[model samples]
Target chain A: MSVDTETVRRIAHLARIAVKEEALEPMTGELNTILGWVEQLGEVNTDGVEPMTSVVDAKLRWRQDEVTDGNYPERVTGSAPDGDDGFFTVPKVVE
Target chain B: MTEFTKLTMAEARDGLKAKDFTSVELTEAHVSAMEAARVLNCFVTETAERALMQAQKSDEKLQSGTGGPMEGLPLAIKDLFCTDGVQTTASSHILEGFVPRYESTVSSNLWRDGAVMLGKTNLDEFAMGSSNETSYFGNVINPYRRPGDETPLVPGGSSGGSSAAVAARLALGATGTDTGGSIRQPAAFTGIVGIKPTYGRCSRWGIVAFASSLDQAGPMTRTVQDAAIMLGSMAGYDPKDSTSVDRPVPDYEKALTGDVKGLKIGVPKEYRVDGMPSEIEALWQRGIDWLKDAGAEIVDISLPHTKYALPAYYIVAPAEASSNLARYDGVKYGLRHDGKDIVEMYEQTRAAGFGAEVQRRVMIGTYVLSAGYYDAYYLKAQKVRSLIAGDFKSVFEKVDAILTPTTPSAAFGAGEKSDDPLSMYLNDVFTVTGNLAGLPGISVPAGVDGQGLPLGLQVVGKPFDEEMVLRVADVIEKAAGPQAAPQEWWKA
Candidate 1:
């Protein structure tokens, strides 16, 4: 299962990583190499085997549905690349 | 009277308790060593001021006879763990200067027990690469070079900086996170001790997630006993991490009674991979003989799925990484490259922020989990992971622990395998199984290769049974005596 240049572009888009037209071919080759190597897993007969959901068999711990921590907006956005009045500011998504 | 930097954590703890040296003096020694070894690029940021301040506080506690277990002990943190007010980059350009508002549970636990920070050490960006070359900061030079060769070698990564730091004695011990073989491989490369405890043994709360299931924080130290002591302080349950096991962390140091009598140690034939160097094979034989001489019953075992671990790791780790790193868009934090719109901005920012290796992984991850390929790739890999874990489960029922070579070979020159990702990935072939099974494993520097480079032997134990792992590793350390430390070539 090799990924073509178009698939690389598609996945790169899906991954939110921009790839130049000239670089797509090399990117495709790199992805295909890794993908091809991982293809060896196909040889393992996984019939009736359950896919691992949890590495450790522990039940999820339940807690009361209340705010245990937070209320510091400044701290929340302290490292924001772009912020306006303690809210993360991004390009206009609407309109 | 001794070089304070030469003291191990245990020795320093005793020396401080006996009033032989203050924490500040010990910290100063390490700070000086770190300065001298700056050319190795082991640290992304050096927190000498903060470390000194913390050490001063520890000295006060020591004066009052209230020092915590790790009080005044300066340790390096892998940048993957969040340190409050200290930049944690995971050695990525994207997070070049990102500081967390809160500390990671593991590091916070260390500080709670009196450990002082020596700043964040470099790692493969997001813990992605086998060689430190992928670090945005720069590749960490393994302090151990081939005999008299001046050519720089890679400290096995993505915990390369932490491994190199500990190996170079820049810090008494450093924190390392192993997802696949990040911790063990580097430790093996640098001829030190590193242990990745059971998956939930250490809290993952504030750790920058790579492969959520596989990533575990552990210790990289000069000796197995130090790894044991550090692991005791590092392991605990945290409510923030839902997966954290609600069990009492054992006195791991006490478990190092050096008793392997009548214990069953498995030698999986599958680990003797094709083209493994003669020295590594001989080292494995010596390790087995050492154990056998110590009254350990060495049993031949077959973990057929052992060969599939690295390949399976590539699928699971990146899939989780793609999801985890999705949070790194333009608005949140770190580097941001502006684009026309939100989507374009994310694309540009990520493209510019992540390095080639990281980009390649994210791409592979995106491809595997994308539409139509999820079942064929992601799900299949997970099933293979289960089979790998199952193999260990069955083997552990018979053997107390398993012994194998930590890495396929000793440290290779920088750029030797960087061009070939698969070849670099093969470095973790022996170490990844422990991560897949969520078991504790430790690497002990047992011998040197023909190049006079260090090699390590590994002991993988049952789930949450780090005590047994430490016990076996301690025996190996005693048998190996002491491997040669790298000459201080980086000193100006």
Candidate 2:
């Protein structure tokens, strides 16, 4: 699986991490190297094997839907990069 | 007594309880040591004021005979563990200046047991790198060095600060989370004791998520017994983390029988990787001899999937990391770079926030999980992960624990392998299998290489069998006997 600059640019956009145009070629080389190494997974025979989602197989316990915690809105939003009276501020999405 | 900073966690605990020395005095000593060891860049944030306040409270409890299990013990916290009202960055620019409103469950457990916090220790950014060099705060210098070499060796990561601080006696112990070999590898490198308890043994609630399934919080201490004591307090069932195992927290300190008689120890033949340092092989052999000398049975075992652990880990960890990190899209918290639009803002924030290694992993993860490659890459990697875990389960059924070298070699100098990710990934070759299998593992300082840098022997046990792991590690520590790093030059 050869990763090229276009793939790097696409994934970088998909991952929502901007990559400067000049750095794309270097990123492609590193990403290709990593993907090449990971290609070793192809050697393992995994026929009929279940993908291990959780190492421990316990069921997720269902809890009451009511509010179990969190009443302080200030604490929840205090660390937001841009915040107002009670909500996070961002580039206007609805305009 | 000698300098209070020099006391082990056990010694400090006893001395505080006996009124021989006060927690305030102990905290003061470590605070001074922390200040002096700034050259190591081990601690990103020092909470000396809060430490003193907590110590005063601990002293009152000690005086009244009402102290908790970890009362008055000062320790360092890896910044990955969210500390309420204290900046927790995971040593990354993305989380820079992020003061978590709630404490991570593992850290809160320690504080509830009366452990005093010295500060937040540095780590590989987002706990991703092996050699701590990836940390935005800068690399933590290993207190241990090659004889006559002052080039500043790395204190392995992403728990390098915890291991370095503990080894340098800046703090008696520290909390470290292991996704791959974050805790054990650094512990081995710094000549300290670090244990990664069973997956879900320690609560992950409020912790900055790395690779969720493999990520686990554990203790890094100077002594095996101290590791046991700290692990006990740090582990428990928390409602906040559904993955947390609900079993009762055992008195891990009591499990340190210091005797491995009648125990079946497996020496896995597969761990004898090609081109390994002779010192590591010799240390593994020495570990076997010591266990045998203590009356434990040594049997040869094989984990064929071991060879694939590293490659499989890279895929799975980064894939999950890509997913977990999506939440940091310039909205909720931390650093945000402004853009003309919301999507561009996210791209700009993340691009400026994460380091190069982090960006690379995210790109790889995004590619693998992308539409066309999901089945061939991510799904196949997941199946390989199952086989890796199965390898351990089959072996554990036949033996009580497995013994191997903690890392392929002792601490390497900073920037030694940073340019090549594969070489750096090899640092976790011996330790990641345990995480893949969700087993408990500990690294005990076994001996030193020709350069006098410390080498460690790893003991891996069945899931939820940290007791056995600690017991076996205690035997190794006794055999190795209280190996502390030679005078920390950073203190000068």
lDDT of each residue in B392-441, candidate 1, tens digit only? 88888899999999998899999899899999999999988888889899
Worst 10 residues of 2 chain B by lDDT: B482-491
Residue A8, candidate 2: alpha-carbon lDDT: 85
Residue-wise C-alpha lDDT for candidate 2, range B208-260, written one tens digit per residue: 99999999999999888899999989999988888998899899989988889
**Best candidate per DockQ, number?**
1
Q: In candidate 2, which residue pairs clash?
A: none
TM-score of the second chain, each candidate in turn, equals 0.99, 0.99
Each model's fraction of native contacts: 0.94, 0.91
Candidate 1: clashing pairs of residues: none
After superposition, candidate 2 runs with Cα above 4 Å error = none
